[model samples]
Target: MKVQVLLRTEGELAVVVGEAEGETWPEMQTVLPALLRGVADRVEAHGEVPDAAP
Candidate 1:
């Protein structure tokens, strides 16, 4: 599987986008959280914290 991740930040807020091809929706869904967490971890390492949904 191939995954692509995009990150956007505005001040202290950050948004993440993840994309993958060659996978079923269920398969993609299963892998997304880990991908997103990895991206989030990298972003946070640079001192940007993503906004939490309320």
Candidate 2:
């Protein structure tokens, strides 16, 4: 199965859109969460520092 996920961000908010081919919706159900969580984990691992006060 092949899946493509698109993420869009506006300021501090984000939206996720996903597309899959050669896979059933139910199969995508399982794949999506794992894929998202992996992404989240990677982002967290990278860490971020807040901007300094102006």
Candidate 3:
């Protein structure tokens, strides 16, 4: 499976992409959420999340 996400903040833009292969559907399900969480974590670590609604 593969995932791609685009992040835009302030005046900057970035792209995050990842891919992994799973032997079964259950494994694939796990891999997908893990991949997405990793991406979200990376973005948060960079302070991409705003404190207040815009």
lDDT of 2 by residue, 1-54 (tens): 777765554665454445556557788787777677655654556566255221
Using TM-score as the measure, what is the rank order of every candidate, best first?
Answer: 1, 3, 2
lDDT of 1 by residue, 1-54 (tens): 666777866765445466666557778788788788877676677875669321
Full-model lDDT for every candidate: 0.69, 0.61, 0.64
Off by over 4 Å in 2: 6-22, 48-54
Return the TM-score for candidate 2, rounded to 2 decimals. 0.49
| Model 1 accuracy (lDDT, Cα) | 0.69
* Residue lDDT tens for model 3, 1-54: 443445556877665555677677777777787677776776677676877222
On lDDT, the stronger of 1 and 3 is 1
Worst 10 residues of 1 by lDDT: 8-17
lDDT of 2: 0.61
Q: Which wins on TM-score, candidate 1 or candidate 3?
A: 1
CA shift of 54, model 1, Å: 14
Given candidate 3, what's the lDDT at residue 18? Answer: 55
